[model samples]
Target: MLALNKIRPGVNGLAVIEREVREPGPGEMLVRVHAAGVCGTDMQLYHGAGAFAQRLKLPTTLGHEMCGTVIALGPEAATPQGAGRVKVGDLVSLESHIPCWNCNACRTGRAHVCPNTRYPGIDIDGCFAQYITVPTSIAWVNPPGTAPKLAALLEPLGIAVHATLEGRGVSGQTVVVNGCGPIGLMNVAVARHFGARRVIAIDPNAKRRQMALQMGADEALDPTAAPPVQTVRDLTHGELAGVVFEYTGSPDGVRNTFAMVGALGDVRWCATPGQPMDFDFGAWRKSRPTIYNIHGRRLWDTWDVAAPLVYENHIDLQPIASHEIPLADSPRAFALILAGEAIKPLILCE
Candidate 1:
């Protein structure tokens, strides 16, 4: 099997090379990967930064968001939960977070933020290859005829769903998505579908701002051209946004996100910054907004809601999948993202 691996440290250390496929271990499944999406975490590894970057053992396959077919399952592969059962021919989308099932978080129904969580492409070998061997616990079986490319998007789409379903639920409220990245653009559509009164998207890139509008945002503002805080305030008629989804990890963007929220609103913080930045608690105290730190999706709960939106075609995801590249030429996918030419590029593993 051929896999895309981070063979060295520092920036741009990826290589596509041949490797023997490993058989599934006990309670694991061997999957024939069809398509995998390059995401922000993969970019972090490409730059050799952050906590996840430090945990990498060299020559690890670098993707987590993927759709694949089940080829074989090892002994005791059945899930104890009695749902999401996987058969030999099932198409599946992965939950990137591999939580320790014995933790208090898992037992108490908060497994999404389990302290002992391990991620694919970071803590273990991931799905950017012809064949991937993984624990069956993280796989979500799709309908028999799910499109491989769209099924590949379920994992990331789950993030947008999780954020939209957070505090206050986006219904009948003015919402602002402070970044127009892949996940942010998805949030724009999700917010609209969930009955948001108005959706405003903010980004410096004109292409993304335009994409945001196409995805259902009522307004898209270039943060570089005009101050986002004032623009959102003016657009909201000085009431400000009732809910602000923060996806930009930059210092300025973070500050603007706080400023754009109405008093007693909800700020769903989704993005993780590469470095720490200063924040004003005084300003935060004045707004008194409820802050929810969103991580990955709620195990099965988020998947149940997210999959249907895609399955039923309630929210169009065609615009988010900007490009597709073959697994052998997977390096170009990362390059396209770095150059800001593609939103989410799928590496076709099959």
Candidate 2:
């Protein structure tokens, strides 16, 4: 099997090499990798960020967002039935992280926050290979005829869906997305499709601003030139955004999120700050805005609602995928993402 792996910790140590995949054990399924999507976290791993260097066992395959077909099922495993159900030859997208079911969060239906979670391509071997084995419980079957490339995007799309659909409906509300990365761009499209009357996309990149508009943002502004809060307020006719989704990990963007949100509005901070953000409680108290720190997608049933949106074409992810490269060329793909030249890069493993 061909796999892309980060063999050791360094500025650049990722390598594409061949490995032998052990067959599936009990309750596991052997999946033939079809397409795997690269994410910002993968870029971080390439640059030796996150807990990858510490938590990951060495020489680990590093890809999480993946779509595949069940090549073989282990003993006691049975496929589900329905429009999008897993079976032999069924196209499927995997939930990369499997939580320990005994955790407090998992028991309370918030498995996304599971304290003892095992993530593929991070904590274990991932799908940047010819074949990978996963617990059947974490796999979701895509509807027949769905594009393999598109199906590979379900993981990150689920994140956007969870962020946008967090609280009450966003229909006809004024919304602001405080980043124009791939997930942020996905939020732009989801916000519009969910009936946001005005969508403000904030990013420092001029290209991303244009991409945001194409993704359905009503207005795009650079946070560096003009203050994003002021621009958003001006566009909203002096009314601050009813909802703000912060997708940038930058300290400035975090600070601006407090200013851009309206009084009593709900603000979903969706970015994972690489460092501690010096947030002001004074501003938060004055505005009295509701703040929700969104992590990964919801645990129990979030994917059920989210998957249909893509399948129904309510949110188009095709534009967000800026590049498609073979698994062997993953190092260059990492470079493009690090350089901010690629939005979402998909790695075709098969």
Candidate 3:
């Protein structure tokens, strides 16, 4: 098997190397990966910073957003928790978060925020390889004829869906997506499909702003050219947005998110900054908006809503998958993202 591994610490220490394939362990499944996507978490590992980077054991494969076919299952894979769940020949998209189902959070249906959660790309060998062995509990089986590349996107799309469906929902509200990254752009489309009265997108990147318009944002603003907070306020006729999604993790962007929302509005804080930064609780108190800290998708609950949007063609993800590179040339995908030239790049593993 050929895998993309973080062979060394610090920036850009990735290499594609040949390795012997490992068989699945008890309650696990072996998958032949068809496609994978590079995400923000992978970028943190690439830079050798953040908590995820600190948790990495060197020479680990670095991917979790993927779609693959089941080739084999380990002993007891069909017994206990996974009984009658996944099986050979099923096409599946990974859930990314490997939670300890015995924990309080998992036992009470809050597994997405399980304190003992482990991530594939950061904790164990990941799907950047031709084959990956993962616990069968995390696989979401796709319809037999579903497109593998699009299925690979479902994991991220789940985040957008979860945000859109959070407190107060988007229907009939003036929504603002304060960043135009892959997930943010997905939120723009999702907000529109769920009946948002108006959707506004904000990003400094010209290309992203243009893509936001394509994804159903009524207007896209370049924050660098004009202040997004005032622009959003003016566009809303002084009412401000009813909901604001915070995807830009910068300090300035965070402050602007608070200022852009109307009093008593919902603020879905999706992205995490790499380091600690100052914040003003006084301003937040004055704004009186409720802040929702979004983590990964809400396990099966989110998948149920997200997967259908893609499978039924209710939202178009084609534009977000801006580039595709072969598995051997996967490093270039990271380069494209770093250069701000690609939205979401798919690695063709098959």
Candidate 4:
């Protein structure tokens, strides 16, 4: 079977290579890849930025947000506390973070931050191939009739669901999304669906700004065009934003976030700020806003929160995907994302 394996450690190292599919290990299941969503993390790793650059082993298949059907299972594939079980023919989305259930973090109800964690695409072979193996425990079976693209997005959608659901109600509140990348746009849609009064989208890119508007943002601003902080203040009638979703991960975006958000507002961050941010603590002391650094969706808990909305068709995510490419053309897909010409590129792997 062919896989989009990262042949080396730099952006240029990414390429599509062939590999043999191995049988699933004990307590694991073999999933035939269907569709996968490319994320910003993949871009960072491709550029050899962040800690994942050091952790990533070369020549590993690189993707985690994916959907597929189970074709085979290893011995005693799953142990259930309830009725849920892993079986062949189940259509599922995988949990990217694979934790050691025996770790103290896992034992104490913090498995999401397990000490010895192995993340698919980063730490191990991931689902960018015809067949990949994973622990059956992390597979989430979707409700029937879910479309191929929608199933592939469940993993990333859980991110928006987690951030929005975790925050205090956005009902009738003005919200700001300081980036209109895929997840940032998802934040806009989720906020609108959950009932925010006004959702503002911020990004320098015109295309993404347009996407933000389509995804339910009341206003989309180019931070470079208009003095963003002042514009946001004026647009909000001086009330400022009640909640700011920081998705740019740029230091400028971080700096402006504190300015655009109102006193006591919440800044729920979901982007990766590569370097140490020079946070304006002096000005921040006056507002006393609550800050949340969102890690990956709160494990199975977020799945329970997001699955119903997705299955019932409350949130539409099809717009976030700007490019659809074959898995064999992953290098081209990666180039598109890295060049900032695309948002989420949905990859199909048969």
Clashing pairs in 2: 172-195
lDDT for predicted candidate 4 compared with the true structure: 0.85
What's the TM for model 3? Answer: 0.99
Q: What ranking of all candidate models by TM-score puts the best one first?
A: 3, 1, 4, 2
Worst 10 residues of 4 by lDDT: 75-84
Question: Could you give candidate 3's per-residue lDDT for residues 1-350 as a string of tens digits?
Answer: 89999999999999998977789989999999999999999999999998899899999999999999999999879755577689899999999999998999999999999999999889999999999999998999999999999999999999999999999999999999999999999999999999999999999999999999999999999999989888898998999999999999999899899999999999999989877889889988987999998999997899999999989999999898999999899999999999999999999998
Backbone clashes per model, in order? Answer: 0, 1, 0, 0
The residue pairs found clashing in candidate 4 are: none
- Ordered list by lDDT, greatest first: 3, 1, 4, 2
**lDDT by residue for model 1 over 184-213, one digit each (tens)?**
999999999999999999999988999999
Q: Model 3, 315: alpha-carbon shift in Å?
A: 1.0
lDDT of 4 by residue, 91-141 (tens): 989888888878788887777778788888888788888888888878989
| Consecutive 10-residue window with the lowest summed lDDT within model 2 | 76-85
RMSD (Cα, Å) for all candidates, in order, is 1.1, 2.2, 0.8, 1.6
| Candidate 1 TM-score, true structure as reference | 0.98
Over 1-350, each residue of candidate 2 has an lDDT whose tens digit, in order, gives 88999988977688999898868776678899999988877877887876655677779999899999998877756533112245678788988778776778988888888988888888878999989988787888887898898889888888778888887658879999998888899889988888889898989988789899999998998878888777787787888988999888888788888888888998887888787657788888999989887888886476897888888988888988889899888788888887888888888997
